[model samples]
Target: MRNHNTLKWMIGGLVCGLVMMACSLSGLAPADTGDSEVDLQKTQLALQATQLSIQADQLAATQTAMAVPAAPAEPAAPPTSAPAEVPTADETKRVNNVNGVYFEYPAWLASDVAASIYDAPPPNADDPYFLIEVDHRVFEFQNYSLADHFLTPLINVYPLEEYQRVNPGAAAQITLLKDLISWQSLGASRPDGLPFLPIFNAAQSFFTKVEFINTDSVNGLRYLTQFQQATYPIQNGQMIYTFQGITTDGKYYISAVFPESHAILEPYDDFEYTAEFEENFLGYLMEIGEQLRAEPDESFNPGLDALDGVIESLRVE
Candidate 1:
């Protein structure tokens, strides 16, 4: 019985010690678990903050990209304009024939002869008493009353040698006239019995008639009245004509009872004549007159007939 009790006591002591140790180990385990839980929570909070910071940085980069400006493109080029054209001068030119001949009478006639010829009535008379002719035909006769002084005479005579000798320079002019008339009258025959009488016969015929009426010779001035018949050759027959009278001075005066057309005799001063007139008027007259007379038309020659009157009216004043 004693042994059994002792065994029971020992067993009981061992059991009690084991129970205390088990309780202390359980309490320590609970404390350590709590400390580990606190550390894990802190780590989770730090990780969350880092993620938020990264998200904010990404948003800021996206905003910066949106704010920046882009560079501009270049503009297109403009078109060019064309240039203007210029004009040129004319290339063709006209030319005139210098050899052509033209003839006409003076602008004034009836007035000029009256002022120079008639000295009887008052200076202002209705009728001018003057007579003149051209190319062996009578032209005008009037009183010196209402007329301009533009009328003068251009004498055409055959006895130019005597006058030409006195005026030596006139020799060339006389020769030119004779040559012109002769050249124009080439196809026609002369009215005078002589074929070419050296141009003196025409003057002689005019002077002969004047000597018959005004036969009174005093000092160097001889007043004559009658005249002889003039002559010229033609294709069929001779042309006979006459002149009334002409003064010694350059003035050609006539009576009132003269024909409508007559011839005039006048003298000219050599110094006053121009070369243009001598070459153009005188030369052209001689050339054209011969051409007209060679044809010899009595009815259809008003213009040529008028030209005779024009020659009578040509003066150098």
Candidate 2:
């Protein structure tokens, strides 16, 4: 509606300008006419009328623009180009170390991903979370997020390698185990008594399940995967996740986490939604988790084909 009125005004302005220009060219009122004061007054009023009409049209257009109509039922996502592919293992020359941790990614992502690739700050300074976007056509609105699995590139390299030994026969398959972070299964204490306890306890309210998806090796580094179920959108994509990490011992490692969705509905903080949506979404998530936990079968896809190259080519410091 506003667009239509703006166009109308624009067209009218063009006509007015043309009429004024044509009158000036044709000499509609010559200086030597010797017209009376009354004629002059009438001409002045006519000009004033034309000016007023233009002003009115301008005012109407302005008002139409300022007036906010009802918002659309759902907002359209902004257009986005494909995220430049993260470097593959083949591109030896282009492979670049990322952030301060020095993990490696394919040259394509190193060159074409986010504008801040070269200097993008580490995602988590305290417990840094590095995000590597492989696909970009998956644009997000309020927050840029992506698919259910393989949402982002993740690599967790802990200082120790023996950590994964707890899961025997983990090399060829993934075993889903509960992590202590879950408020239900564990308490807020750690043996080392690091500062992580306060942080974990602080974050406990939002986090529900923290699962370990483990494997002993993927090429050179011991593979570690973790899924921390929380109210947050990233984990909300699936009630669980399957991730990739790099570790020598497994005591300390770097892991991947991809951003997922916003709370399903807007103004999402209302309790009315929490009871209904949370239960519904949780039920959905458990169903998916069951399938993922099943004996390693043909269905599991951790995006290894796309990620393994980058991981294998990693040049970690």
Candidate 3:
């Protein structure tokens, strides 16, 4: 169980403070009363009234903040030491395993959602495999049903080109090829000399992070390759973090995707929602996007930090 933090959300409180200060400065009233002693006394009273009004306004702002409910704290990090705990003979859940690598999932890992298995492989196929969903899924497209159930941050036993060839008839694969072809067509709009880069740009836009980390071989099986990606939703504020690794046999792929609930993504805040602040948040997107483009570095993937011992202890037979 590991979690990669999503892009830090913009702080709306500073905007509120700046706006209130501006309003107070703009609302100064001039009292140019020139008269006798009584007039001076009247002017003093008026000055005191104005000062009290300002104080009341400031106090109201403070009180309003206290009245608003606080958002729950972000989830604590999970333990990712390596080779997550395996079920004892008595603890194994027979219903959840798919492919030869029996999944000994951590508590945080959800049961595999609807999984697809196609047995008929073309002659070049080297081994049997299974694709499973190990986290909550949200489709990128508007349709609630993916038709063939390929919502990603997914675990694919095979990469795209190979997965399609193996499962040619699967709806997900057919849709994937269609989308790939569609993205390819974007090149038509480019000036003749410009390189077509829709795939790269689209990936850059959707991904918040990409990480590589070391993995282990199990029982001389060589499924050591591993990487993780954190994706932010384009149409919504949801966050999806994905971890993908190959099994020791080099034939199976394991992925765990975590799509946070809306409450988790949209935390509670102090400021009253305003159209102006919303516009400012839109501008903040550019700043976050720049953060997203930082150079990739090699490190222990934070996504699996809590599941430290889990994968290496995988028992693939």
2 or 3: which has the higher TM-score? Answer: 3
Sort the predicted structures by lDDT, highest score first.
3, 2, 1
lDDT tens digits, residue span 101-207, model 1:
11133332222221221111232233211111111112232322212111112222223234444322233333332432334321222211111111110111110
lDDT of 2 by residue, 185-253 (tens): 223222111011000101111121132223343212122122222332223332222233433343333
| Best of the two (1, 3) by lDDT | 3
lDDT per residue for candidate 3 within 1-317, as digits (tens), equals 11111001111223322322232223222332421111111110111111111112222123343566778998988867876675452342322344443434333233333344433223434321122112221111121111211123233333323443443222232342233233532122211111110011011122334333234532111111111111222222123334444444544333444332222122323335455644454233334433433423212122233233343444443
Compute each candidate's TM-score over C-alphas: 0.18, 0.29, 0.31
Preferred candidate (TM-score higher): 1 or 2: 2
- Count steric clashes of candidate 3: 18
**What's the TM for model 1?**
0.18
Runs off by more than 4 Å, candidate 3: 1-97, 111-154, 159-161, 164-204, 217-237, 245-249, 253-256, 261-286, 289-304, 307-317
The per-residue C-alpha lDDT of model 1 at residue 128 equals: 15
* RMSD value for candidate 3: 24.1
